[model samples]
Target: MEIKAIITGCTGMVGEGVLHECLQHPDVKEILVINRKPCGITHPKLKEIIHNNFYDLLPVATQLHGYNAGYFCLGVSSVGMKEDAYAHVTYDLTMEVANTLAALNPEMTFCYVSGSGTDSTGRGRSMWARVKGKTENGLLKLPFRAVFMFRPAYMHPTKGMQHTQKYYKTLSWMYPFFRKFFPQYVSTLAELGQAMINVTIYGYPKKVLEVKDIVAAAAITGK
Candidate 1:
């Protein structure tokens, strides 16, 4: 089947990586990326919408319709942030956009970029984990055809992507070591991107995919 996707957070590392993979994949026929700022990419299969407000989707919700897949990679760090503030962006903001997309595209296979240590119980001691847990649980309740929660740890950034975080570069030298010793905790950005695309097309046994599952899923296409 041809894939038409709505991607968010293209200005960030994860989103950019997924967008790059989608542009290269033959099955991906159309892509609509909604970002707060320009992602500075152009392709025949890609369309970009620059919108500042995610809280209210009334403005651009119409443009969001008809997509069969949603790659929701937008997220914020919780460093020095209070629980309520982190929840506002992590849980509240994500749910708002997700709900809008669910209403617009009921058959959409939604992929959410969650962290490795996320707590699905929503009662975890960590603030960020709890918020993410709530968000994940909430998304499962929505009426989308399929919703996959991706929990990747120490993602090795794809080469030549400019939006990579500075700290990832510093820690990249450890990726090979991690891949050999603790493989389950690491996956490449390419694998992460391919995993999302593959799961959308071929479905998976589990709804929540950890690093190991991500690697296995990515290998399916062999691109």
Candidate 2:
């Protein structure tokens, strides 16, 4: 069966990689992208919905149905932001999108690109981790056919650039070295994209897949 997909954060590094993978797949017939700004890419199968605020999507909630999968990749760095401001972006914005999509398409598979070391225990001191964990938990609670939280560490991209991810970008270049020394904490962007597409296409029995599991799944699928 042909699959239709919705992608948030299409301008980001990982998001762009996933977008490329989805477009390349013959199984994916259409890809709807929602972002604050334009992704600047034009394709016959791609639909870009430019919205200044996520809350504005409520009016078009009914139009979001029938998608086979959704990739929620939108996120912001916690640097220089207050706790409430950070939470609003990391937790509130995510929940808003998840809830809207869940209501519109209960049977859709939701795949979230979460980072490593997310504190599922909401009581953790790290505000970012806690917010991520909360968002992950909330997404799982929704009525989707399947919900997957992909916690990837040191994602090395195949293309594009993320100037903000300076440290990770540098580490990405040294991925070969990092993999040799600490294979457990790293995964390539192509691998991560492949794994997410596989999960959305084939589905997983579990609710969450940590960094190691994501890498393992990616390796298995890539081969």
C-alpha root-mean-square deviation, candidate 2: 2.1
What does the lDDT read for residue 70 in candidate 1? 96
Best-performing candidate as measured by TM-score: 1
* Candidate 1, position 131, lDDT: 89
Whole-model lDDT values for every prediction = 0.93, 0.81
- Per-residue CA lDDT of candidate 2, range 1-223, in tens? 5778999987878788888878887778999999889998889999988888895587667668789789888888788888899988888888889888888888788999888889898999998888889889988899987999988888777765442256665666687898888777877777776777777777665668877778766655433
Best candidate according to lDDT: 1
TM-score of 2: 0.92
Per-residue lDDT of candidate 1, residues 165-212 (tens digit): 998999999889989999989899999889999999999899999999
- At residue 203, give the lDDT of candidate 2: 66
Looking at model 2, the pairs that clash are none
